[model samples]
Target: MLLALAVVPAVVQEAVLVGIGFHGARGLAPQVTAVWPYDSYHDLRWLLIYHNSWWHFLFGLVALAVFRGLLSAGLTALAWPGQVPRPSFAWLLRRNLEVAALALVVISPWAALSVAFSAVALSLYLFASLIPMLVLAPFLQRAGVARTWWRGLPTIELLGWSVLNFAVLTIAGAVISSTSGWWGVLVAALAGVANGLLWRQTVTAAVLPARIRLARVPVAPVAIILTMAAAVAAQPILNLVTGPPQEWMPLVVTERLPDRVPHAVIVIAGHDSHWSGRQPADPRVERFSYQGLDRQGRPLPYRHTATHRSLDSSSVLLRAQVEALHRRTGRPVALIGSSEGAMVARTYLEKGPKPSPVEAVLLFSPLIQPGRAYYPPPGYSGWGVATGWELRGLFWLVGLGRADRSRPDEPFVRSVLVNAPFYRNRTLCPVAGVRMIAFLPTVSAAEAPPGEYSRIPVFQLPAFHGGLIGRRAAEERVVDFLAGGHVDQPRREYALLQRLGAAWQAPPLALVLNPVWAAEREADPAFTGRICEPR
Candidate 1:
């Protein structure tokens, strides 16, 4: 009864949200009922990701009630077969009816909403079967019931009812999810139903009910595979119908140096969602410099920072822009790329239509080794993993799987691979052939191999995510790299750097090839130099 009570309101709420609330958002004409803005709003994504797990608990409770009711009624009828145990029968029937009714309530507005709600409801019901009988002692006992069965009946009914209600709510929730529009409601429902069936359990007891012991169900590996396939396929299709997100881009330029100079620099933005959020206020972007000229014919320090949204796909576009700028400005250009942007610069050098006027390249903490290590793998469970269990649950809810996973084992021998282009495939960059001066953080002897570090000159920085580069002396070293001269003589920590730079006039393909403080050694050949040392 308690579960039923919960279900009834949830179903009603879901129905109202889906049927009336959603249409109002679209300004559609009035139907049998109309909802205000707030009434129509639903958080279906939350329902899909979070509520499904909750429903698992709730459904376990309901399933327990159903199985228990069947047993109690059976035992009583056999003991005294003349009477129908009308009270118990009525309660069981009402619980089922209430849940079913709630499902309908949520489904009335949209089928997809119903499916999502139903899946969550079913998952919850199944999960509830795990709860111990002792925990439900209070709910089992109700007013006007002398027998122990009556005590458990209401709570069981309530559990069942709650499942039904949540199902309805799920439907409504799916309808209102930002990922779903009116059409997605319908598509998602079918997907949700199919996805939900994958985890269906026959037993109803927290301790494993005896009722379903004799039953047989189909289980084929092919079916499981197909279910996985269907779930994966449904999500992108639903998202497409709902709406493709609009990509955003923001650009900021800072030129605070002498004016009217002919100096120039070209920058290729990195590939990460975090890249877009970087702005002038950020010290990282602020400290990062581009070569530009002042009015007095001296080199000017300038910075053009790309917002995070633009960082994802702007690299190839920026490479082309650099070509255009080169034609227009006729200035010597230096190229700076961070992370994935380093790859973009390289690609532009190799494959872009126009010749790159950029003289040099600088890479910071590049994700050069692609494949599984590129991004942290999704966690097996919810917490502690980079991508948690909730996201996996979401994929299940939306009928999605690993179709979008990337393959990085392929060779990079050719400029253009036959199978996929990085720009079209990864949706990042299309440019190729740029040389790079790569700097990576400290790596273990076991992790570093000749193949990974062979051709490229490597500068090992301290800490994760390039902590060494953030140092002021390191920044000056970078400034010197741009200035086209290496550190000259022997010094304390930079003795190796000075020797390498002074011995070799041509810049190495990789930065930090000589040593981390090589440029500083060139700046001060004497033993007294202490610019790079911490005070």
Candidate 2:
């Protein structure tokens, strides 16, 4: 019954979205022809607001309330067995409407901010609003509970669970809405079922019943499996529909010289949803091959659309491609990797069965230990610190699988960081022969211990993470390095370190008291640096 009720809203929403050409066929089908919708947050938001009516939004809110009420009531009945009476549809509907009304009221202020400010502001407001709701919603529900329930309520656990649940639902909804045809409908139905089960379990835990004991359903596994399956299925199809993957293929912008030069440059793009490699217009190197396939073997069209699977597979593929290029051209390769691509290059060189044809490997803002690399240090104080952390947390939650279908690189990157040791252990092939050079930003350089690996030479660049890829001086250094020439003047920027020392630390309550501080950090020179380097 709970599943049936939950599915109604999902089916209705899908139908309505499709009918209005907002979700299926005419809408997502056309947009996702060349790219997946995982990273298209702004576009998706605009579509929802522009294509959908106020009635549609209202209906969705009401449906959400009804579903929550029914699920909670059903779970309560099951848990108490003989003690609690089964709620009638009308009673459940009434309770749900009341709960929904309260929720809408709480969220309406944040929602109204959408009119005055950007969606980003509204999103931050919405996230801020959810913290209180997570803590209070269980208590607010009319479901019979002991007076002492509030005293024993697990606030932290409930908040974490709510965050996880929200992540799952949001990802599921995004996938469903972005997909077209019967496939979208089918995925939406599965998501609805999963949502119902998750809600039932969450309610069961929140409102602990005194009498009857019911066996716990494996909600996490079920949701994970459902989400993973949907993500994997959605990714490749979206890629195929968006257009030919050739547009994303590695382009040989400059023709190779008739005489085979000993060294060739192979550039691997960082964690982006598009073909992001920028070939140097240098005439010294004959050929340049940009990495075409993202970690998931799909064409990268923009940021956040590609899916990421095992780095091992991608590494193997990279090795094969590099080897083929080397064999055909009869030239030794010099690999230049940025961000996640740098990690892939390292993996390939360290783990591949065949020895790398490359003589030199250059890593720009390479993420070797993701946990350490991406983490904000204790003394760091920036405007967007809290927001950045929250966004990172959300990405981590959404990307918890073999493939990050919705937000491709984030989870995979996190997995790589967490499993760095595992990959390191698999480094049976020696990299002593490869002259690896690492160009790290000041902030990242602080985290990375220099000379950890004797063979790889780590240089501290006076730039931000994104800046390393775009700076002309950095690019020239890369070109020189590929040509087996050394960087003349390597300098460290201690400005970030000095600023970290001088800036006042944000209080723990700052997240609630002044959430704007998170955004402020982004603009702060102390956190991001004073240098205006392009990415």
Candidate 3:
């Protein structure tokens, strides 16, 4: 009921806003739910939250507060009990509000990024994972719930329960979005209650915590842990037996635009997208963002193929394309690579023939320098990296040592493993006129050394797993950069929502994780926040 009090009001407000945004589209629930948290944030951010109309903007501000601030305070209030003669309601409300506010200092950065991802799943996880520090900031609370970390139960929680909770609630939100009218209201309420129960059980460990306490010998914990372990280990084994669906999207070039443009963009795609990839045969400016850039550099088409004999071979193909494009156009070329494709782009730039004709490069989610993935507990970052390591061990343990990464690895892990690293770091040689930048997600790793990205702007977006390309904000900035517009990355975040605990354009993860990003390492002279287009 308390959780409902927190979740339902905002949800209702969101429903109205969705209705308004839908602009009389039929099936409010279906329209709202069709794209989900991705489109949810996009519409809210662009159309509503930052709408041109004054009243719409004001309403968006209030709605944002109701959605985030209220939820935080409510979660804090709920988790705040268990202390002696629990404080009075008035005092409880005030004090918990204070705690939620302080936690906001921490949450804002992450929240901004979550909004950036456009996926509520990550946002929910961000809140669930960290709010436990605030005792019931909604979803899983580690300090209170997972008391069996010493006995290796935390591994299960981190690898299993937390993921489950994040995924389920995300789906639940979608379910709620899918209902409307009076019947839909009831359905939404019921869905809200169901989610509340799950959140309560997860946040408080209602079911397992009690059993854990009663069974002093960890019998319950062990049994539960083993079951979860088997479940986790089972899926991959099944996949190994029954390989994943692989439907590769081939590059189709039918001469839609002039091929001899001034700047040709070449994109090197990451691992199997289920393998979805599309290359604009004859784009006006050679890439998505460079459509208007008749003079600026253009990136190569994003390329993905399972047929590459090796990473080196992939880079060779990139060089061949780069040379071929430059020869035809007699113009400079830019390289845009994502995931393993980013590594392939990096290799060509670093080791290709000297006096490199490639004048600009944009690496999306590259793995040029992945930090140590497997460290001890409180392992803050590197879940993506950790998964790769875990998979290697799991496959080896299951007697599949030779399992090819082509099928075995997730995109994140494969990126890290692809450019494993040299005995030592390579010296960077950044060109004076050339514009080189990397659009990074939440994870650390500069993708290049201090000097390599010394001049160009390195964007820290809220995207991951090849999601940067999908974000509107990222696309806008990328278009500007590709078009040769001077990029001015933001140094500090827009502070309008500091009091309300809102996060804007800055990377929320950098506040604690990446000091390099937080410091805005080596931004150019033309740096400007994308919060608004200030003349």
Task: List, residue by residue over 232-264, the lDDT tens digit for candidate 1.
Answer: 354466458756432112121232222332235
The residue-by-residue lDDT of candidate 2 on 1-535, one tens digit each, is 6566545556665555455433211112211110101112112222223212345554555554554455434533433333345556565556544544544444333222221112111122223333343334333332222223323333344445445544554455445433445565665566556655655554554455433222244332343344334322433454477553332222222433223234766666655434444334433232222334455333233333442544666676677667665665677877767665676777777677555687778776664222211222224433223333333434345345725333312445435533433332221123667766777665453222111222345566666553566566666566566556665344534423422211011101111123322332222111221212121
Which candidate has the top score in lDDT? 2
Angstrom error of the Cα, residue 1, model 1: value is 63
Better of 1 and 2 by lDDT: 2
* lDDT for 346 (candidate 1): 55
In candidate 1, stretches whose alpha carbon ends up further than 4 angstroms from where it belongs are 1-263, 273-315, 372-435, 443-450, 486-535
What would the per-residue lDDT of candidate 3 be over residues 197-219, giving only the tens digit for each residue?
A: 44444444422343333333544
> lDDT of candidate 3?
0.39
RMSD of each: 23.9, 21.5, 17.2
Candidate 2 ranges beyond 4 A from true positions: 1-261, 276-304, 372-393, 396-411, 414-418, 422-430, 446-455, 488-490, 494-535
As for TM-score, the candidate ahead, 2 or 3, is: 3
Q: Each candidate: how many clashes?
A: 52, 13, 15
TM-score to native of every candidate shown: 0.30, 0.37, 0.40
